[model samples]
Target: MRAVITTEAGGPEVLTLDDVPTPEPKPGQLLIAVVAAGVNRADILQRQGHYPPPPGESDIIGLEVSGYVSAIGAGVTGWRVGERCVALLAGGGYAEYVAVNAGQVTRPPEGIDLVEAAGILEVAATVVSNLDAVRFKAGETFLVHGGTGGIGMFAIQYAKARGATVLTTAGTPEKLDLCRTLGADTALDYHDDWVDGVKEATGGRGVDVILDNMGAKYLTPNVRSLARLGRLVVIGLQGGVKGELNLNTLLGKCATVTATSLRFRPADEKAAIVSRVSDEVWPLIASGRIAIAHQTRFPVDDVRAAHQQLTGGNHVGKVVLTF
Candidate 1:
């Protein structure tokens, strides 16, 4: 099997396609013949030595994949060889084959091809998990930062589908238009006073739920932009790690803040999330209420190019690597 191997932690140039032993399924796992893999910011961070794979997981740099089951290990039932499925992986997706726990595999939504399905699991799981944690309800206002990215785009569609009035922030006009087309009620320029814009869009009540990716950079402003009893869910730290919080403001608004990550969770927890997404979110996808957006596809051998595209920050949605 040929896999993307990093010679050292640095730039995209370090990623090279090399022959490696094909992974075999372990108990209760499935060996998938990789068809396509989703490129994520986590992969770039891993390549730069900022993020490493979780303990006991593969060192390869991918978090989600779509493919066919080539084999299944003991204790795995109800799934067969040749079944088309997508998986939320902890690692090892940048390869010709990957071994994943059977519980993490899900059937692609009806009418979606395997290549596009590669981008579904990670974004869907991330958005759904955070929204569930915040107890996001219909008829509330939802705001998502980085609205043009994979998770951001899906978050907009998901929130709208659930009956929330959605607002999003993007750096470019093209991205803002795309967000509106995807159902965001308002799209604000991230480089401007987005906090003020969010409040205005919500009729000065502020947003009830916020899906934030810019951690420390937006912490204070995020607090300011929340309505009473609002919830802020932080999932990325592109801005920075440490920031001061205004306890007084939070108390006044009765707001809550939560930070979460999906890759390092326990197996059973990941299984639960995967199961919920398959059951609840898949139907939304099948009905076309939520859609998969693919900005570009690069061959597996050109993994470096894929990484570059993601880091360049110009792509509107997911950058997929095809086998």
Candidate 2:
């Protein structure tokens, strides 16, 4: 099997293409002939040696994959060899094949191409789990930072599907337009006074929920933009990690602040997240209520270029590498 091996902890330049042994499924996993794999920020961080795979997991670099099951472990059921599916993985997605846990696998929605399916699991699971954390309700307004990216686009669509009014912040007009196309009722320019824009849009009432990636950079404004009992869920810290949080502000609005990362979660927790996303969000894809926004595709050998695209901050959706 051919794979993009991380020869060392460095830039994308370190990714090397090589023929590696095909990985066989363990007792509780499925060996998938890889079609495509989602490129995530975590993948880039891992390449730089900042994030390592969990204990006993593959040292290879992908977090999610979409392909057909080529072999199944002895105890796996409800799926069979040759079944088209997408799955979350502990690691090893940057290859021609990946062994995925049966419990974390989801049948590809009908009509979704394999490349597009590759963009689903990670973003879907992330958005759904964070949305769950906030207990988002229909008719409520939710604000998402980084609205044109994979997770943001997923959150925008899912929130809209549930009848929530969605708003988002993006640094470019192109990105903001993409967010609007994805169902955000309003898309503010993150480069500007986003808080004022959001406040004006809600007639000074603020939003019920905020999905933020910039973290500390948006912390103060995020606090000021929340309505009573609002929930702010932070999933990325692309800005800065530490900030003087205003507890009084939070208390005054009776809001809540929470943060999470999907890659570091335990297996059972990941399995449960996958199950819930498959059960609740998969139907939307099948029915066209939700769609995968796959913006770019690079061959497995050009993973370095893929990483460059992500780091360039020019992509509007999920970037994928195909086998």
Candidate 3:
């Protein structure tokens, strides 16, 4: 079986396509014949040696995939050979075959293809878990940073479907328009005074929940942008890690801030997130209530190109690698 391997860590050029032995399913896991895998920011980080796979996991870079089951390990049920599925993974998705825990696998929506399903698991699970943590309610205003990116796109659609008014921030006019087309009530330019824009859009009341990716750099502004008792779910810190939080201001506004990363979680915890995503998000996709718009696909051999594209931040939506 062929797989992409990083013989040394540095740039995308460091990645090489190599023929490796096919991996077999371990207990409670399922071996999948790889069809497509989603390329994410974490993949780029892993490639550059900034992030490593979790303990006892494969060194492969991908965190999610869409494929057909080739074999099921002992103690696994409700699955069989040749069943089409999308699965959340700790690593090893960038290969001809991947073994993922049965609890982390989900059947693709009836009409969606493997390429589309490949991009679903990670973003879907992330959005669902963050929104659940925020506990958004109907008629509330929800603000999402990086609205045109992978997780932001899913956040926008899911927030709207859950009856919240979505307000998103994008860096360019084109991305802002894309957010508006995807059901955002307001799409503000991240370069401009986005807080003022969001305030105006929400009738000066401020947003009730904020899904933030720009962590420390946006911390002060995010706190200021929140309404009374608002919740801010920090899912990524693309900007930086260290920032001073004004505890007094946070207390004055009665707001709460929480941060999480999906890749480093324990298997049981990831299983729980997958279960929730399957129950809440799968039906929406199956019924056409939520839409996934992936803008690019690269062949598995061109995995380095995929990483470069993601690092350059030029792609509008999900970037997937096909086998």
Candidate 4:
């Protein structure tokens, strides 16, 4: 098997396609023959030495993939060899084959091609878990940052499909338009006074739920951007990690702040989230209420180019690497 490995973490140039031993399915896992893999900002961070794979996981840089089940491990039932599936992986997706927990794999919805489904698992799991934590309700307001990115694009459509009024921020005008087309009620320029824009859009009440990726850079304003009893779920730290929080503001609004990561979670927890997403989110995808977008595709051998496209920040949806 050929997998993308980093010689030393620094830039996309470090990514190399090298022959590596094929991974075998562990108990309750499935060995998938990769058809396509999704590229994420996390992969870039890992390549640059900023983020490492979780303990006991593969060192390869990928988080989601769509493929055919080539083999199944002991204790796994109901899934068969040659079944088309997509999976949320901890790592090792940048390869010809990957072993993932059976509970974390899902069959692509009817009418969705495997290549597009490659980008669905990570975004679906992330958005579903965070929205579940916030107790998102129909008719409530939801705000998501980085509207053009994979997670943000899915978050906007998923929230809208659940009946929320979705607002999102994007860096470019074209991206903002794409967000609106994807069902966001409003899309604001991230480089401008986005907080003020969001507040104004909601008649100064702020939003009921926020899916934030900027971490410390938006912490204070995120607090201010919340309505009473609002919830802020932070999943990324594109900004610096450390930031001051005003306890008084949170107390006054009865708001809550939470930070979470998907890759480092326990196996059972990941299984639970995957199950919930399959039950709730997959139907919307099948019905076309929620759509998966693939902005670009590269061959597996061109993994470095895939990483560069993601880091360049100009792509409007998920960048996929084809096997």
Candidate 5:
């Protein structure tokens, strides 16, 4: 099997296609013949040696994929050979084949292309699981930084579908417009004082909830932008890991701050999240309430180009590697 292998921690140039032994299904797992794999910022981090797969998992760079079940392992039932499915994985997606626990697999939403389904699980699982954990309400205002990225775009639409007023941040006008098309009520340019824009959009009341990926860079402003008793969930640290926070402002607003990483969770926990998405969110997708996100494809052999494109931050929505 052909898989993208990194020679060392560095740039996209380090990623090379190499022949590797095919993964076999273990007990209660499935051997998937991967059709496509979703590229993520985490992959870049792993390539740069900032992130690594959980112990005992594959060292492959991908986190999600759409593929067909080639073999079902012992104790796995209700799945047959050759069923089209998508999976959320701890690792091992950037390859021609991957072995995933059966619990992490679900049928892609009807009418969605199998190839594009590669882009679905990671974004959907991240947004849905986090929102559910935070108990985000329908009438509450929601803001997500990096609105053009895969998770951000999905968060915008999913929040809107659940009846929340959605706001997002992007660096470009075209990106902002795309967010609006996907149902963002307000799209603020991150290059500006977007915290002030958040305040202005909410008429100074601040938002009821925020889904931020900027971590420490936005911590203080995110706290300042919260409405009374608002909740802020940090799921990434793209802007840096450490920042000062004003406890007084957070105290005054009676807000709560929490952080999570979907990629580092245990398999059973991932299975639970996968189940929640399949039961609750998949309906939204199948009903077209959650729009099919913008997708960009790169051939698997050109995985280096795919990494470069994602790292360049010029593409909207998710980037996928086709097999």
Candidate 6:
């Protein structure tokens, strides 16, 4: 089997495809013959040495994949060899084969191409878990940053599908338009005072939930953009980690702040999220309530170019690697 390995902590150039031993399924896991893999922002972090794989997990840098179940580990049932499936992972997705926990695997909704399904689960699971934490409800207004990115695109449509009035921020006009097309009620320019735009969009009452990937760079404003009792879930730290906040304002609004990494979660917890996604979100997708976000695919051998495409920040949706 061939897999991508980072030669050192550095740029996309550090990633190289090389022959590696194919893994056998551990207890309660499944060995998947990879069809395609999702490339994500976290992959860049790992490639640059900013993020390391969790202890005892594969050092490979992918968080989701679509593949066929080639074998099942002991104690796993309800799965058969040769069934097409997808999975959320702690690591080890960028390869010809990956071993994932059976509890974390899902069959993609029928009728969608198995290859395009690769990029959907990781972002869907991320959005669903964060929104579920916030208790986001119908009729509430939701705001997400980077609305044209993988997570952002899905977040926009998923929130709308659940009946929330959606708001988003993007750096380019075309990107902002796509956000609106995906169901955002308002699209603000990230290059401008986006918080002010949020205020204007909501008529100053603020939003009920915020899905922020910018971390410290948007922390204060995200707080300022919340309505009373609002929740802010930070799922990325593309911005610097350290930030200042006004305790007085947070208290006044009765708002809460949380940060989570799907890749760092315990297996049982990830299994639960994956279950929710398969049972709930997948239906929405199957019924056409939630549309598939756009995607760009590259052959697995072009791993460096895939990383460059993601880091370049111009790709409209999920960047994927085809086996």
Q: State the C-alpha lDDT per candidate.
A: 0.92, 0.89, 0.88, 0.91, 0.91, 0.92
Candidate 4, run of 10 with poorest lDDT: 307-316
Tell me which of candidates 1 and 4 scores higher on lDDT. 1
Reference-based TM-score of each model: 0.98, 0.96, 0.96, 0.97, 0.98, 0.98
- Pick by TM-score: 3 or 6, better one: 6
- The C-alpha stretches of model 2 lying farther than 4 A from their native spots are none
Lowest lDDT block of 10, candidate 3: 307-316
Candidate 6 per-residue lDDT over residues 1-323, each given as its tens digit = 99999879999889999999999999999999999999999999999999999999999889999999999999999999999999999899999999999989989987788888999999999999989987888999999999999999999999998899999999898998889888999999988998999999899899999999999999999999999999999999999799999999999999999999898899999999999998878888888887888888899889889889988857789899999
> Which runs of model 1 end up more than 4 angstroms from their true locations?
none
Q: Tens digit of lDDT per residue, candidate 5, span 134-242?
A: 8997899999999989999889989999899999999889998999989999999989999899889999999998998889989999999899999999998888999
lDDT of 5 at 55: 92
lDDT (Cα, tens digit) per residue for candidate 4, span 130-172: 8887788899999999988899889989999889999999988
TM-score of 4: 0.97
Candidate 5: count the clashes.
Answer: 0
The local lDDT score (0 to 100) that residue 187 gets in candidate 1 is 98
Cand. 3 TM to true fold: 0.96
Which TM-score value belongs to model 5?
0.98
In the range 6-118, model 1's lDDT, one tens digit per residue, is 98999989999999999889999999999999999889889999899999999999999999999999999999899999999999999999999988898999999999899
Our model 5 lands, by Cα RMSD against the true structure, at 1.0
**Number of clashing residue pairs in every model?**
0, 0, 0, 0, 0, 0
Backbone collision tally, model 4? 0
Greater lDDT among 2 and 5 belongs to: 5
Q: Is candidate 1 or candidate 3 better by lDDT?
A: 1
